[model samples]
Target chain A: MSAAPPSPAPRAAVDGETSRRRGLGWLLLVPGMLWLAVFFLFPTIQLFFTSLYDPSGSYEQGYTMTWHVMNYVDAVTDTWNLFVRSFAYAGIATVVCLALSYPLAYAIAFKAGRWKNFLLVLVIAPFFTSFLLRTLAWRTILSDQGPVTSFLQTIAVLPDDGRLLATPVAVIAGLVYNFMPFMTLPLYASLDKVDHRLIEAAGDLYSSPIAGFRRVTFPLSLPGVVSGTLLTFIPACGDYINAELLGTPKQYMVGNRIQSAFLTEHNYPLAASLSLILMAVVVVMVVLYIRRAGTEDLV
Target chain B: MTGSLASRERATAAVPPPPARRPAGRWLADHLVLLLGILVLVYMFVPIGYIFALSFNQPSGRGATAEFESFTWSNWGSVCEPEGLCESLKLSFAVSLTATVLATLLGTLMAFALVRHSFRGRSASNLLIFLPMATPEVVMGSSLLAMFVSLGFDGVLGFVTIVIAHVMFCLSFVVVTVKARLVGMDARLEQAAMDLYANEWQTFRLVTLPLAMPGIVAAALLSFTLSFDDFIVTNFTAGQSVTFPLYVYGAKLKDFPPQLFVVGSAMFLVSFAVVIAAELWRRRRSTWSR
Candidate 1:
């Protein structure tokens, strides 16, 4: 293979070659970009408009574009508690995920030795099963007859005859369990890329282990933190399956409401408005989050 | 996607294990992270273990998933006992297969373009690719449904819409994963091929494509898994269609059948096997390349 060399191409030839490939590049891009334009960009614009439709319209009669901006207001006021609960639960789940994953990701990155791949696979293995099934597994685990409940009861953690299912605690547990992998993988990616010598260098400078981590390793891994949090927080914030399967109505998040509005009540305006509001809030939160994390390319 | 892990694993695998005997305090300190890791892994795996166990459970009582009455091999053998379960699985497979192919093709091409060519709207195009991933599943679902309804396609919302939605979401991830691999690629190899008088297409077919194959395969795997496991967007866009997640969710509203656990365990086992196979294959290929 090494014996087949002809002559080295000149610089002008390389430039010409690059220019020649430019048209083909966009040719390659158009199909995917067009798909996004149709499926992503257009739908977002469509959702924004649908959010402004008249709330009084129905499917049989066909909805009119009344530009009802109050749909957003009504959506907010009607489901304010759901919104708060959703963010609060997702926020807590994100924090818990970060905590649980940090040590595990750190171990995988710096300590697992030959078992790194095996351990990392464990992070995403649960997700290979049905998301609903895993959440339902929580339902069983937290049920009154389950071992967790019995143990908690015996230890005086839960009251006698008191249950865990249909509670906010169960719902939050599901969120944390389901999304923790999303947090762990990204954190592992960033942590794995960190130069091991940097930590040793910090130790040579007389900084303690905790101080070295805080002053060096942690800062470099903020990209993972930002990305991991965003990935976990976004879907966790929008998730209704955990809340629906493990939670009663009292524990329902905005996702439950939005879902019901679309599926059961057939209130397109309300659902669209709710969806738009969720998107807007998530985008704003992500932008501010990335800004604070100071890693613009977290994706 | 596995690129980050692949490079690090070999580097860390050579480190020698700690000595067997040590003081209690020192041992605890040295293995603290390891214990924490094992605990975290257990937390992640306990549910899967329960599901696998329940796959063989004989449901003598209601709330089948809630209690394990007796062990039976019937459920795994006859997973189709529950109505609509197999049908939903078929639909999910169809959607996932179609979406994965389209997504991998489009995303791989887009990745090559984004990495190799600087265009007028490349930055904006990158943002557009990132938008689908940044948006929550529920929002993405509802927005797509809203667009479908507005465009008078609500009556037709089923498999086609599900495929579209799946591809749309999966495409961005495919682009990013492949683009990362492409960006990390050394262009000198391709230039060396060119210097050896190989033409552009020949170079791509023989050298460039092989280099990008791992990333492409990873993206395709990711797309299929995402599409198959998807619930939120699939729920919104699938009017009369029921994918696997939807089927599982629907079962919860019913008798909460035991057969579903079989399905869950099967999914985990199959995907884990595929992952292991792919990893092994990649290792052999890498060795051959070196």
Candidate 2:
């Protein structure tokens, strides 16, 4: 894995039968791509159609496709704050995840030497334990009488009445923690691809460590940065678990609203509309961000 | 510490080019980033520690599970004492295993096609693979549920629905992971095998499959992990069945059980041990191959 073959070798020989091989290639793609088309692409299209269902329709009577564009209008008008809040929280959490993951990924890529694989294992080890269990554990640690909250109170970083649980800070903290690996792994992948000699050359030219990183290492790792931020932000925006467990209703993001609107309330139209809105905003942001970052290989 | 130190020394010795003697400041900078990195990794493990510790905590009553009431061996001793706890665990394993198999097989095929073949609609297929991953879980879940509802499959939502949903989401990740591995591979190995008069099938079976095995294994592990830990998609589709995550979510509504933490800790221990053993085996195998 450390070999880092700089130039990518060409893929398997084309076998010299373009037409037949084309059919063969399509055969291989049929199973998985068809699955995605049916389950993913179609469902999304189905969801768009569902979003146009009459607002009064419920799951019981089945929805009528009245093209009630008002569903989207109502969804935005009603939950604009939740949309704003979700993006805000996810943005903050993504930035925090980037800040924390960059050094760790940098170390693993360039500095860990023989310990890289072991340390990488440690990074992923926590996933074996369920995320819900870990998030619940955070609830205990941030509880009013828990050590973290108590320590904060004692230090006066928090007011006497203030606590970590049921606060936006706790919710964001959970987001940062849970989605951190998403940021780190991509950063490490891109960083590991970087040529160390480039940085060494920069140093040979008497560039300082920070300047070398800024000029050489950081620029090379931009692909990872773009993907990491996207990975963190997308999930953080959609995640209801952290907010539901670590926060109060006041701290609830659009995710919490979507969950209740769909599952609890059984309001399919509203849920579909909310989901569309979220997906649209995310797709737009991601397109612009990817355009700026210039990495079509992210997928 | 000594093992790591000795290994580091051996690692440097094995390489032909000795690293130049760095100034004190450079050495400090190098070690400082590594130290900072290790510290962050350790900090991430705090919750796992808390889970293991809390598993020993037999919360005295329904309201006390959030705090450590007292330490006792009872929770571990009777990990399955809570009703439906073992049942949910079994269901989760069954669901995740089936999903992992389906996702890995399909994804490996897609990855091979994407990386090794120039076919029509390939870029479109790549976009298809990317779409599910880019979409939020909530969006995917809601959309899937909408599709099911429209098809009148909502009433039959159970084990099968959960498996389908898991495979759908896990497929994208598996494709990407396997594709990365395939793209990085040395294709000359396959060409050499072919040049040696190995048939296409023989070369693929002997060379390509073994090379792709690591990525497939990783993708399978990832799919299983994602399926097991999944809440949103499963919740949307799992109508009557209770996977472990569903069980955990349900526990919060009523009497939160201390046994949940015990089960969680046991899972951590078992999985961590397996991972460490695999790493050791991989190291030994790599060294032997070298």
Candidate 3:
């Protein structure tokens, strides 16, 4: 049932009801809000402050805020090449995911008919396994002695010494494989909402099928495209697991750098700076996209 | 059905030209989209098949062999009867279950608040809730680690820490999902119950809660899957305890254990069953509603 039709309820009655509801709502939200504020937001703010001050041995040397602005500079300029490479890999993976997922999503949304649900389930099934296991499985498949290598050799595609594992290509492939479902599901939702009659009408107007798709289907699916790309690209840019498991040192992304800085190098300031920069980049891109396409473009 | 019929009528009225006999090429072209879809599906699934096949292939008694000349259950048996593998699996399930329960409670409350009320700073809180969900897991993990260390919360990295981290991350998903369901729900039913002399708690229990159960269940299942499958965040937070993924990661570094595959396959099967069940339930509910 929809809302009750407008009745001239007394103003005092409505005010009392609304206020009571508001009070209840606040009560409901208190536990969650307090949990997040103390645990999540507070820690993140602490991280920002920690980044500004240099730690002396332990966390509590009564440290002063030095505002190591150079931490940001060092993260960007010192490891500038790595940062660029991370974006390059993430960008390529996003494009590849788009190229592959669009057709699959289109088919499931518009053409698969009875098989669409099964196909969608198939896309999600891989995620059932641990991500590490999937990455390791790739490692086995891509190893020099693995069947894939041998098959490539048989097909004359291998350059006798070319390796698949620990390469940028491998890293990108892993990223695409891992994140493709994120791209597909959103795209499918968008495509499914499109009115097929629009395409039929375009066809009736003497538009070619390709022209009809370009004019009708593609434009309607722009929201999905933008959302899917954002989902894949942002995570891909920040991914370290795949690169660490699949790629060589040269292929390390910003995520890998941050992980090492925090874990091994003990460089909290630098790590925080890098983390902030990565977040800033993502926020800016999202803001720009939202401005251009409207917030509804995101799911 | 009415929309489709009206559109079909409109099409027939507009295009009176006799249907041209479909050519062979036209038939092929019409089905090309489906064919490409199948190809994409194959690409997505083949690697999974390859992994399964490799898992079963017997280790030729020398080194790792890719050929699947023989299948053996030794790997599965070995993993099942170990000093710690089973323990790790038990810990994983326990931690995940605990996290799911906590997350569902907090997240559902947050969702209720977000959907049912208008309050100051509501928008900011909404954004804050969602931001953690979107943030990179690595950043969340390391930041939590930093936070824990800063607070002198030593040895807080075992089961408690892992569960806490999981709940923290999973809370947002639950909030988002439940809020969506709440947005679509008719609030008038609760109001009607209240009008019938039911208190707020009674109305929620009798009317709102039952209606929201499907969404709550879905949210719970999703949170469980997320917590169970999480590696990046747990890796940072789980101090001494080794969950299944952490175990697999450590095992991989030394020698990729075939047992890891068996454990992986077991997890995959369980999660797949749960997801399929959830999907079937959702479908049945929708059909019943229809």
Candidate 4:
């Protein structure tokens, strides 16, 4: 792939061409960037501004520029528990995904050769179906008379009266199942890149297979671990669907709180404040992860 | 070289004291983890299998007992009825198709800019493109709603609103996917074309686009799947319009229709077929390359 390196003279010319191309590039990017800035980013900034000023119970009400920063305080105090629950569920789900996906990723990346693509496709295939549909399926499978519960009863794991639906466990299970592919794919990508010869070299140096894995394979795959965890944890923290579908009121996450605030409760300022806070949490975590992983390691 | 010779000698010497190994037992011990891994895969697939089974099960009109009963095609029949699943499926396909195409064109341009150009605020521009994807969907939806209302638009909240939302989110994936491919590609190919007197557009069309086709196809397919499967943002933006997933969700809560499973199973089947085809195409490409 690196057979022919370009000459320096041509490289300089190429660099000039690339710069010229970049000018043209801006022309192409402007339309899309303008669209996002207008529709997405501009509104987000407006949301922050709107949150600071109370809405006069009408969409047409103009905001008072006087910063009612108290909206942030009010939102936090009101929905503190929901924020805690969101992070708690996402945190647990992240750990569970790691525990399950690591071995499966290892199996696909290192063990399976001929069937590797088949197995990877199998992992991804369920995702093609709507995520909501999959969650709804879990609702059925965990319902009172569902086969899963009946089987559990036959094995004496639960009493006949025990219900699995509308529980935190079901919500977490739905989350872990839905996001497992995100965790596995990055792990597989990293694990697949680990040179087999390095493992052999470790073995030749009198390292046991376990020791070799710990020293070489594990460290190299840390990038994948970090990326996978970030991908799963961040999204899961803000997820509302699983909690709303599979869980009772007690399982409401920050997302549910935000939804209800805006849609059900019709408190736009509170919802806007909550949205800003959630975005801040996500931005901080991403910055922290990027710093820890080093910017170059992420891609 | 010295360590290799020494290890060879050690292996020859250490084998003298060993009992002859039983190959089958060693094989079993070595493969136990992999077998267990397959078991875990089966466990992960069980819910999907249960859904598939229930979709075909006859409706007994009773709670859960119907799942254990004799099989029937009635649920599927109901899903296929003129007033039912077909309408949702048509809307889903149309919206997903429109979103994918618009996103691909705009996203590919942004990707080209990011890869092939240098500009002021480039890093921040890249981050801005990615922020929507990283932001929570509910937040995105609510903010978009606010934007529409604040702009004096009646929150169009139908096909147009849903398509715009889908494109807004899916474009980031396209940019990321295509930019990764662009970074890996050789700049010399297009440079060589330019040196041969091809104009910029000609060079891109003849040399760059073909090389970027695989990434473009993957991005398009991914965006299609995402747009098709989206619910949260679509639910917020889709006021009166009923996409398939939204329809299923509404039905599940209101009537608990047994045929919802049939619709879900059909979706699963369609997605499975597409994925399998993609896998096969990829494999064929690799073999042809070899």
Candidate 5:
């Protein structure tokens, strides 16, 4: 490719063409950027502004922007338990998803020699069905008289009268089930990119297979682990569907609080404040995680 | 996808000692991960199997149960018997279609700009794209609703608001997917077109656009599914407008008909078939080209 003689004129011409193309790039970027600015960035700023509004106003009467930032204090104090529980549930679900997905992704990336695509399709096929319907199915499967509970009871895992429905266990289980694919796909993507020779080199260095996996493969797959956990944890924290469908009020997350504050209770300031807090925490966590993972180009 | 079993076996043959003297413990260790993977797959499908079985179940008087009662095809026959069910489904389809088209068109343009040209603030634009995907749906939904209310569009929250919200979230995925394709594209093709004296428009239309179509199509499909299956963001923004998920939520509170399961199962089957067909077509196309 570099065998041709270096020509100054053509090189200068190429530079001029690229610079001209740069001018046209803004035209192409404007449409999408403008849309995102109006709907995404602007709305986020609006949410922050809304968070500082007077909390005493009703939804119909409208909120007044009095710069009363105490709404954040009030919102946090009011739903502090729910906030903690939400992160706890999400964190546990993320860990569980990682544990379950790592092996499955590894199998597809390494061991599913001829059936890799078929196995990957199987992993994603269940997601084609409605997520809400799938969660609802969990409700039935974990109901008091369901097979899961009955089997648990038979094995003495649960007392005869103990039930799975309306429990934190059920809510967490729903979350793990729902976010499994999110974790698996990213892990598979990174694991599949791993060069087989690197692991072989580690093996030749007198490392056991497990040692090679830990020292070489696991480090290589960290990007996937980081992104997968981020993807799973962020959404899981804000998810109210599992809590609403599977668990009782006690299992309600920050999402449920935000939802009811906005829709059911009509407390705009509270909801807005809560939403802002969730966004801020997620952004901080994501930035810290990406920096620690040493991957700047997440997208 | 390319490595055959024989190649994999050969690859491992170079790594391991001869099988004649290999320890049984090492063999079990080698296969344990695959076994665990199969178990996880079965675990994922358990609820799906339950959902499929319940689709054929005769739930006692519209109250959905997990129990597999007598097998009946009534749910399949009258899938739309539930009031407002089909209406909700239609609303979801309409919203997903509109969101997909708008998001795909705008996102493809952004992808081309990011990949094919150099510009200041390129990294900043990339950050903006990642922000939406990173933000939780609840936050995105509430923030959009807050913006709308502040702008006095509170009462007008229905189809338009839902579509807007869907497009906002779907944009990031579209841009990322199409940008990947654009970035991985061969620049030599466009260079060759220019060498042949093809104008920029002609070159783009004939070479670049065609190469990016599969990515754009995949992104559109992904956006459609995300929009259709969305419940979290839609829930906050959709005022008095019930999508399929919202309808399902309502049914959960009241009585869930077996027909809901039928709809879900049918959706699964249709998507599965489409995916299979796409894979087969891709395989055929690659073979033909080769």
Candidate 6:
């Protein structure tokens, strides 16, 4: 698995079959492409248009295509705090996930030896259960009378009345717990390819182990770090389940707001605008991050 | 210390020798990540443990059992005791099945096309495939809902809308998984079949399909799990429909039944068994071939 054969070899061999294969290829591609274009792309365009609909018009009253750009401006103004808080919470969770996952990934990549596959499976095992159920369990774990909070209080890590359940800390913890696998898998994939000999060579050249890791190992693993952060951060930013289940309205992020707006309040324009803004921001961050990571094969 | 010293000596003396034992500190450092990794793994399973343990608990009062009143085998015996739970579970199964089949069929074809044949707009198609995966669930859900509302399907949101949403999101994942398998396949197998006086259809049926079966199956499983587990996208388009997760969420508001925990536990165990069996079978196959 470590050294996959390059993809171009078979392409070169099949280059002569173009005329017949091309028609087959197009035929094969049509159904999926048409589905995506109709459902995904067309919906996205509708969403954009919906974002610009007249905010005063109710769903029953029928929204007009006024191209009301202030919906974007008003979305930013109204939910700017929530938007900023979303990115902030997701950013911190990404960092925390990185901190927790990097060592684990490194261990599995280099040290697990015979148990590598088992450990990797273990990493993904928790995900088989519903994420919502898992978050709900965290509510029990972090509840006022729960063991975790009680232990924290006993250890003086918390004030006697201080609780984790309804705070940003809980929300962030949920995000970290939920997205850790995303961070670890890519890190392991990249770290698995790091040659042990290079670290040994660094040691042999009189560099200390820590220095060797800092200068060599970490740099070699930067691609994983970049991809892992992006993967963790992007979904984390849009996640509302954690906030909804584990936190109060005070800790609610943009997702919670957008969800309520669309589903409960029937505020289509606001929800649409918020959705588009979040997508725009996420795309920008991901592209900038991938570019900085200097990888062209991210897809 | 001694291992490093010996390596240092060898480095300076330009002579290779048997490696020395690592120092205690280095050994600790080497194991530290493993220990930490184990701890992190344990942390991940805490909630799962809660789910499993709570499944057997007899809650004294209603409103989502936080404390275990007593241990009982009743929840497992009557897993569908909760009203609407079984119905929601059945709905989830139906929707996920429909979505998985549609997504897998469409995606596998696209995967073959992308991997085996060059096409115009290939890069654009790739980007199109990736857009859904990159976009957040909230955004995707809202967009689909917006599209449905605009098309006057708002009143008719239910099973059909849920399946459409599930298929749309699951398609990209299926394509990616199957495409990886197709790309990694040895073209020689198919070529050799053709060389052996086999027609194109015969070559595909005999060689290509068999080799790609694992990936297709994997993609199907992934699609099924994703659709079954989906809540956000379904919540938007489902309207009055209740999938399993939606049932659980609604139960959270009214009465968090221990039976829900049973369902969660069962889902986990079933999927876990499938994965483990697949892994063991794969290992056995490799050894047998060798």
- Tens digits of per-residue lDDT for model 6, A150-201: 9999999999999999999999999999888879988998899899999888
lDDT tens per residue, model 3, A153-259: 88888787878888888899999988888799889988998998998786665444665677778988997898788789877888898899889888898898888
Prediction 5 global C-alpha lDDT:
0.87
Better of 4 and 6 by TM-score: 6
**Residue ranges of candidate 5 with Cα displaced over 4 Å:** A1-16, B1-26
Over 4 Å off, model 2: A1-16, B1-24
Q: Give the TM-score of candidate 4.
A: 0.89
| Alpha carbon lDDT at B95, candidate 6 | 99
Residues A1-299 of candidate 1 have per-residue lDDT tens digits of 01011212222347776676777878999999999999999988888887898999996686899899999999999999999999999999999889999999998998988778877777788899988888888888888899999999999999998889988889989999988878998899999999989987755554446656877799889989988998999999899989888888999988888888887888988998998888888888987887776676665
True lDDT of residue A238, candidate 4: 81
> What's the CA error at residue A79 for candidate 5, in Å?
1.4
Off by over 4 Å in 6: A1-16, A197-200, A203-207, B1-25
Candidate 5 lDDT over A1-299, as tens digits, reads: 01111111221157778778877889999999988999999999888888888887887787778999899899888988998999999999999999999999999999999789889889998998999989988988999988899999999999999989999999999999999988999899899999999988765554457756887899899878987998899899999999998999989999999999888887888888998898888888888878787875464
Error of 5 at B220 (Å): 1.4
- The value of fnat for model 2 is 0.68
Q: Tell me the interface RMSD of model 4, in angstroms.
A: 5.8
Model 1 ranges off by over 4 Å: A1-19, B1-27, B285-290
Pairs with steric clashes in candidate 1: none
Q: Pick the DockQ winner.
A: 6
lDDT of 3 by residue, B83-178 (tens): 577888899999999999999999999887777676667767777776775577777888888888777775667898898889888887798778
Model 4 chain B poorest 10 in a row by lDDT = B17-26
- Give a tens-digit lDDT track for model 2, residues A1-299: 01111223334455666666667778998998888888889999988988898878776877787999999989999999999999999999999899999999999999888888888888888767888999999998899989988898999999998888999999999999999889999999999999989999766655556657887899999989988998899999999999999999999999899899988898988988999999989988987888777777674
Worst 10 residues of 2 chain B by lDDT: B15-24
Shift of residue A170 alpha carbon in model 6, Å? 0.5
TM-score of candidate 1 versus the correct structure, residues matched by position: 0.92
Candidate closer to the true structure by TM-score (higher is better), 2 or 6? 2
Tens-digit per-residue lDDT, B102-139, candidate 5: 99999999988877666778767887888898788999
Each model's Cα RMSD: 7.2, 6.9, 5.3, 4.9, 5.9, 4.2
